[model samples]
Target: MSKLSKLSLITLFFWIVKIVATTLGETAGDLLSMTLNVGCAVSSTILIGVFLANLVTRLLSKSCN
Candidate 1:
């Protein structure tokens, strides 16, 4: 598993991506809701769509051995 228990480099890469994605997502959500004056519901829906797209790609990828 590339030197870590059931944790390959590819898996680690995805993990980093997921973390960064969520971090940016949080920022974007806040900006949309507060700065841009978008309502919470609309911001939430937009974030949900973004999360779902990431979820799809994550699900399609192979898991670590």
Candidate 2:
């Protein structure tokens, strides 16, 4: 018997998108807190709220399947 791999093109695309988005988010966060003088606490709170809102929206949305 041979083992089969489960990874597909769609999965690979999503993984790439996730990595890029995470890197972008981190860079933006650093810029906001450091360059813009927004302060870590304020920037974090704003970002966290945005993240939670997106999470809830995605969770409530219907699945493609």
Candidate 3:
């Protein structure tokens, strides 16, 4: 008996999007805290709040399938 791979096009797309989003998020965070002089503590708090809000919204949303 042999096992087969389960990777699909959708899964690959999801990973690509995740990587891009993560890179963009880091860049934006640095810009906010350093370039804009927003201060690290405040910027971190704002970013964390946004992340939590998005996470909650996604969790509460219905599945597309």
**Model 3 lDDT per residue over 1-62, tens place:** 22323456667789999999999889979988999999889888989999999898889889
RMSD values, in order shown? 5.5, 3.7, 3.7
Residue 52 lDDT, candidate 1, scale 0-100: 96
**Of 1 and 3, the candidate ranking higher by TM-score:** 3
- lDDT of the structure predicted as candidate 1: 0.87
For residues 1-65, write the lDDT of model 1, one tens digit per residue.
44675567779899999999889988998999999999899999988998899889888889843
Query: Candidate 3: which pairs clash?
Result: none
TM-score of 3: 0.65
Clashing pairs in 2: none
* TM-score of every model versus the real structure: 0.55, 0.64, 0.65
The most accurate candidate by TM-score is 3
> lDDT, candidate 3, residue 39?
89
Write one digit per residue (lDDT tens) for candidate 2, span 37-61.
9999998988899899999988998
Candidate achieving the largest lDDT? 1
